[model samples]
Target: MTDDDLIARLEQQERDLLFSRFDFADAWRLGSLLVEMATERGLPVAIDIRRGPQQLFHAALAGSTPDNDAWIERKARVVERFGNSSYLVGRRLAAGGRELDASLGVDPARFAAHGGAFPVRVEAAGVVGVVTVSGLPQAEDHALVVEAIERFR
Candidate 1:
């Protein structure tokens, strides 16, 4: 899809994927659901869920590497910093015809404006955490997290 199309889809995703309630138990359920989906599809992925600086769930499936873990961290940083999906942030940068380095003073090494990490927004509570997956293409990684969250909700 075109960049604008992708951005629009991500925007809609951010708006639609809201949880009525989210907690530690919900994190476990979402993580497990993502793992099951990945295992069933033979997808090599790493999953992570976090609230503020506290990591709630983490898993590295078969074929996933340490890089996947690192990607998850960077992507999660984007969500925590901007309170938006990593994909959406990345797309917004592109939509503005800018790069992360040129548009923001933030170090690219610490935060990535890529897909995968999505904010866990609770109604009335706003963004409380991030759920992320790494290993697939950026869009696929983002889609995986979105699908898992949909199922979890």
Candidate 2:
């Protein structure tokens, strides 16, 4: 196969793997998958998950410095607390309303980080949680969560 073809195949394989929704034992499982995908793509990543007030799981890859777990946690908390991601928080705030700042026990400045993170909501179980992936650029982190959510859905 040509180099282009080989690259296409590899990309397809990664996409397929990422799109599969294997059973997540908990938020940790979800975070682990993100790490795996990030590693496969040669992207440094730090991943974390939270369910309600508790941190479900967290990990920083070998090359990743332990930058800030609190920020990752904040992203998750905002998602779970608001039942949506911080992206939504802007709307609520822009409407001339105040949000309770749902970072839970996490620091308020934690949300200032530029990485992507989101809440996990299981309608069947009535459970809400958050998932975050850092280390990559902010858009990439957001894309990771978005892709995972799409796969899970």
Candidate 3:
């Protein structure tokens, strides 16, 4: 899809996906679901769920490495900072001929606008947490997280 098409779809995903209330239990359930889906698909992914700075769940499946963990942290930071899915932010930036990383003259170490992390938006509570996956292609990582969220709902 074109960058604009993808951006529009990602925005819709953000709007349509909402949690009534996301607690520790909810984190566990969603995290576990991501793991299960990844395992079934044989996707070597690293999954993480967090509330602000507090991490609630994390898993690094076989074949995943420290790099995947770093990607998770970076991508998660994008969602946490922008309150938008990392994929959407990346697509928007790319469309403008910029990037979330150093190519845009921005700090490259902490934030990654790649497609993997998603904000956890709760009803009336706003975006409170982040859910992320790494290892697959960025779009696949994004889709996997979205699938788990849908399954959890």
Which regions in candidate 3 have their CA more than 4 angstroms from the true location? 101-106
Residue 150 in model 3: shift from native, Å?
1.0
- Residue 136 of model 2, lDDT score: 67
Residue-by-residue lDDT tens digits, candidate 2, 1-153: 644554354334223333222234755566766767777888767777766667677888766666746557666655665555554443334344444444334456655424366655454444356677776666567778777656544
Global Cα lDDT for candidate 2 = 0.58
Candidate 2: where is the Cα deviation over 4 Å?
A: 1-24, 90-110, 113-115, 124-127
Question: What tens digits encode model 1's per-residue C-alpha lDDT throughout 21-89?
Answer: 888999999999999999999999999998778899999999999999999988998998889999899
Q: How many residue pairs clash in all the candidates, one count each?
A: 0, 1, 0
Using TM-score as the yardstick, the better of models 2 and 3 is 3
> Which pairs in model 1 have colliding backbones?
none
Model 1: weakest 10-residue lDDT segment is 97-106
> Per-residue lDDT of 21-127 in model 3, one digit per residue for the tens?
99999999999889889899888989999998999999999999999999999999888778899999989988998867666555768888899999999989999
